[model samples]
Target: MLREKIFYKDELPVSVITANIVDYPFHFHDDMEIVYVLSGSIILKSGYYTYTLKQGDMFILNDRDMHSLERTDEDNMVMMLQMDLSYFERYYPDLRDQFFVVDMEEDKEENLSVLRNIMAEIMMEILQKGQGYEHKVIESTHNLISCLISDFCYVVNEDGKFQNETGGKTSKILAGRLNRIMDYMYENYERKLTLSEIAENEKLSIYYLSHIIKEATGLSFQDLLSYIRVEESERLLLESGKKIGAIAEEMGFSAVRYYIKHFEQWFGMHPLEYRKRYMGKSMTRESRAKYKRCTPMEIETAIHALTRGAFTETEDKLVLKPVIIDIGTAVGDDDNGQPKTAETSAKDPKEAGIFTIMERSVNDILAEPYHLLMDLGETVLAAGENYVITAEGTDTKDISRLSILVYNYDENVGRSLRKIHTENDLLRLVRHYDDEIEFLIRCNGFSGLYRIYRYRMDRENLAKKLTDSLNPEGGAGKRDMLIGRLTGAPTVTTNTYTSSDVLSVRTTFQGMGVELILVDRI
Candidate 1:
């Protein structure tokens, strides 16, 4: 009867926790549960299988599964998420019909990282409880569930065996006949379905179809049918006051004794006992007082630790075929000992209008100049006024062009608002901004008609994304969980400029995000 405690949150269908789990007596609920090992290790005994899960490892237990946890040699911090399928399935429909598992034989490091990032965010959301926190938490809960359904759901391979796989194979797994057979079993579990009937429909012999069902699901034909029937009977037993014989007959069991036999085999109890054992004892806000709830600092630590490498998405990169101009060859006045691009070329070189240019930041001269600046190669020079950190590319003296990248780091927002989606949250980030940068760079020695290039990494006001993603009612709570599951890139553009012996370029960039300024010879 031990629950992750959905009743505490009341109407909200998603419950989450980040805790130091010591041990839990064997218990299971109707909600799907996921265990993500954050620190140390955990030992879980679910049904017949016991697994030792280390850091970054995860395990999923389907609805009504009888499972328990045990501590290992090391101390462990686990993040757990439980979703009430009875509420979410009303929208997703097929959500509760599928089983989810992880087979350690397959390499799932990527999947594990993805699962951790989402789980970590969910922990922060609940603990912080910021404005629109409920909406964001539910949205992420849906994302976590969709990942399980699409990525980790059990699937029968071509050989009619359950295998854990990755890389977009859900369609292929479900399209196979074995999947169809499994679907058929769930669809008609309440009614009588014989192997011959299924075989006839598939145009295969009863014997062969029986073999496929066993090999595909790891359960014999009759046992698999009973598995589905007994699992389904839980609702009627708990929801309705129907007598054992009536419920049994309704669930396609010919007699009361047979139904009781299947119920005991699956849930370790008969129907009446299951109801009496769990139904009467319900609804505690805490999963268990002994299970230490994580502090805000702990959750923040976990978020950063998890997002350190694989969790934060790879920065979008752009490979450009730049016109490599050897700046060293630029013609210069012999007396001045500096490149004179303006006098060498027939056309008059462009003046320093861009340096004095206003609001080129929004125009994306080099995209949100702030963030784009940081994103450029590596830190070469950094300085004062509005906290500047500039990165550079290869040496232009030896190569074609000179680039200076600059970006901003706003520490005011903190971890909770790291990935801001709500208008209120974004305003908190935007309102604190001093999004202006004015600097003067006087080109030393060489100078002529040089081109000013803006490398743009497009960063739109993602506030518009909320309109397309979240509903007008501010997300329909768990209904959004029924809704289904990374981009931005860099670009280069050439603008006019003229260089002189003492080329003084004074530029003013205004706005937020990344910016990269590039200079190259004609």
Candidate 2:
């Protein structure tokens, strides 16, 4: 038995192979494949169907279709054509959910022979690799597909009904019902779901629904649910900056422990460990290093260096002037020095601060005259004009704000342009474009989901324009509008910084984590 191969070589989305074999063990791939018997015969098993493929017989298997074959005749020769679904999707987008039916049992012998001949021609062209062989193979493939559509095949619709009859309506109906159930589960996996609830919604009896689901999927209802949950969790783990616990909760797992247990069982590694391995492969060493966690002093120093001139090692120790804004009086600072309310001090024209990065200790800067300088978390200087600073509140309960402080070196005037209340922990900020700034804010407080926001800066009025949210699932909500989640505050680094074009901000979510989000300036 050979392990399933999910990837193909040579950057080709399609592969054509002619082989002679005695037996082939069960295997699966995330690509559509056609097996055409050129000589002899073979017993093929795919899902619930088992068929004896004689000479000139053809069958098609869809993505994720588990199949195996055993030689019925000694001289078993077959031509297998495998194609990535995404490759065809570019031209045939609607083919995604439609299954190509090629069961020889349901096909006339004459039609089966036509498909076989077309497949043989395609295989020959692929093997010969002559001039214009690629085009010939493609033409032959199209011919075979045309024959299948005209005689042997029928398109399975979204409701699981065959557009053209080839028999097996009952089987198609059962499969369709199971598919609908699976679709429902995928769409609402974030909420608590049960067999009874699903049965009620589908108007099916609990016992019958359970039986059919097991029969159709070869997995019990609970087992299927667990599999879907685990799969979704894996996606979130790699795509979002959400912590393991947050992912477990979002997928409706009873606890993070169960999520970890099932994830490890399916992937052979813990979720966190999987993230690390994934990140190592995807991000470059320089990109990964940009996300290093910097203290408040380090971030402030970086800003100070940028304000003066180009950053250099010798100038890093050069203490610059500090700008202090009296936000405490306007918003009323709490015991931990966070604003008690979410109101911006910019509403009061008189409540702004103006100063420079001074040569003094961070502690000294935080004292009188600079008492209003909040602890900066992540800071970025864009075009050396706009200073975007993310304030890390004293604690998790501290709902912080993102301050876009603009400074004029020649005029010696600094003003807070936008003071938007970030309902969660302020993580990082980077200039996404010339007039836009991006902020990564924590959702469920500290160690939860990290979300990214792109705001267009209004230089004159110091206002922000909400452009778009780019999360796959959708935005978090009005208060958050976070496009995605992260395990924690990521090490963010600016990639492309152009005043006219969009700025690229690359973030490494969590140390040694696999998740990387690239937010582009609008």
Candidate 3:
């Protein structure tokens, strides 16, 4: 089959393409793609969702997902770790379950970034072709797959609904064949592809393949091929200075007019406009301007926790209150599997519904930072207009002295601030708005920083404004804020530093003498 050729014989042995990261149309592939973000940020659009990736992030693309890459900011030097699954199978049969094929039934976002830095370095080392390159490559591949499975397999496994559900015969076979066909189309995108050609290659009657293709993907086989061709053509057009007619001809289109029709039909814009909108942003240019390659110093910083005796009982003393916001289909049993109707479970608990929405929003927002806050469990506070702070020790009495405040962002602010675990985390967040507040205050001839702050501190209207300003969409402000606070000098010292520079802060704040108070800051 043409699909088998793409993966088994032709494109699978060794495929390597290192290019600038730019926006491309939706497309699929038969080979496995191992992409490492050398520098900068990228937005990956696949199927119905988009994934935003940062430097030190790498993702595997298989499952023949129709995805594309977009870079909003420059410096996206992405090292693509593409492998023909066939080679993977030959080289390491045991790793088949690890990198065999993306489970088309599941999403690839979760846990894919586990040990990203290590894997990226391995990939970089291979690209550099140092001593024992072959050995290093094999080792790196081993480590990469091991890390992925160990850290992230849980995400795919736990999200049972998204994973392959047991109980499908024809659907599974049809899906698998469709995946095979899509892979073939991507591998031979620049070559001529016809319905009869694919049908014959799949060893299915032309009539059956036609019906199955349409039924499976909701697009005619011919239209799907045209879509794939135009998509690849779009990538080449934007990434290279190829002429429109040349690109059309190269992709097997009958003429430039036919190419234009397909391109316009798929992208809602002409080829030229589409190229202009998506192209011009290159990984080389962006990475050079905004990102510096991981220096030995930064790598050392990431490895600080690994140093012997570098951390002692005195250093892990910070007790942070972490609040888990429950988000999901908690409001009503809307688990994406049922027909919508006026049901009994829908109307009873309005507050519960609100809590569920807030919980979900909070979870989504703090998804990245929760990793750092794993150990510090001071109190699980339910935050809203009223703050409900709870801690398990008899020392909870003094928690009030710490001045705990809950600030909720406004509805229009784009993000929900309800998920932040503690007032200290919020204070660190406030530092990000320092420049913006300073500018607004100075421009308006405000009396003082406090006066300007008072407006933003308004719980109903201004708090959300500040929250939005601090955590803008796709902005790294919150991360910077968290990093700053985490590495900051706290006002009160729970432990004194010794000459050895090792200190531990006792988290006994929630202990016997501790008190808890909830204040509304916004």
Q: TM per model?
A: 0.44, 0.40, 0.34
Ordered from best to worst TM-score, the candidate numbers read: 1, 2, 3
TM-score of model 2 (CA atoms): 0.40
Residue-by-residue lDDT tens digits, candidate 3, 9-71? 221134344455565445455566666565567887544445677765555665454556777
Candidate 1's residue-wise lDDT over 1-522, tens digit each?
Answer: 233335428345787778888877566565788888877898887654567998777777776555677788788888777888876674356777676775444535655555666677667667766643554455455556655654576655555445545434333221112446666877987788898888988777888777755544445789878877876787777778889889899889988899999888866677788888666454232443357777768767766765542111111211122111112224456556765442233222122122222123322222245444445555433332222322243233333355554433223322323344454554444434545433334333323345566554323432222232333545555555334201223545544333322233223333334456666666
lDDT agreement with native, every candidate? 0.54, 0.45, 0.42
| Superior by TM-score: candidate 1 or candidate 2 | 1
| Tens-digit lDDT string for candidate 2 (76-165) | 666578876665554335554655666556555555554554554454444445543443343344444445435544554554345555
Which candidate ranks first by TM-score, i.e. highest? 1
Candidate 3 or 1, higher TM-score: 1
Listing every candidate in turn, what is its Cα RMSD in Å to the true structure after a full C-alpha superposition?
A: 19.2, 25.0, 23.7
Best by lDDT: 1
Position 107, candidate 2: lDDT = 57
Angstrom error of the Cα, residue 386, model 1: value is 32
Taking all chains together, the TM-score of candidate 3 against the true structure is: 0.34
Cα misplacement distance, residue 175 of candidate 2 (Å): 5.3
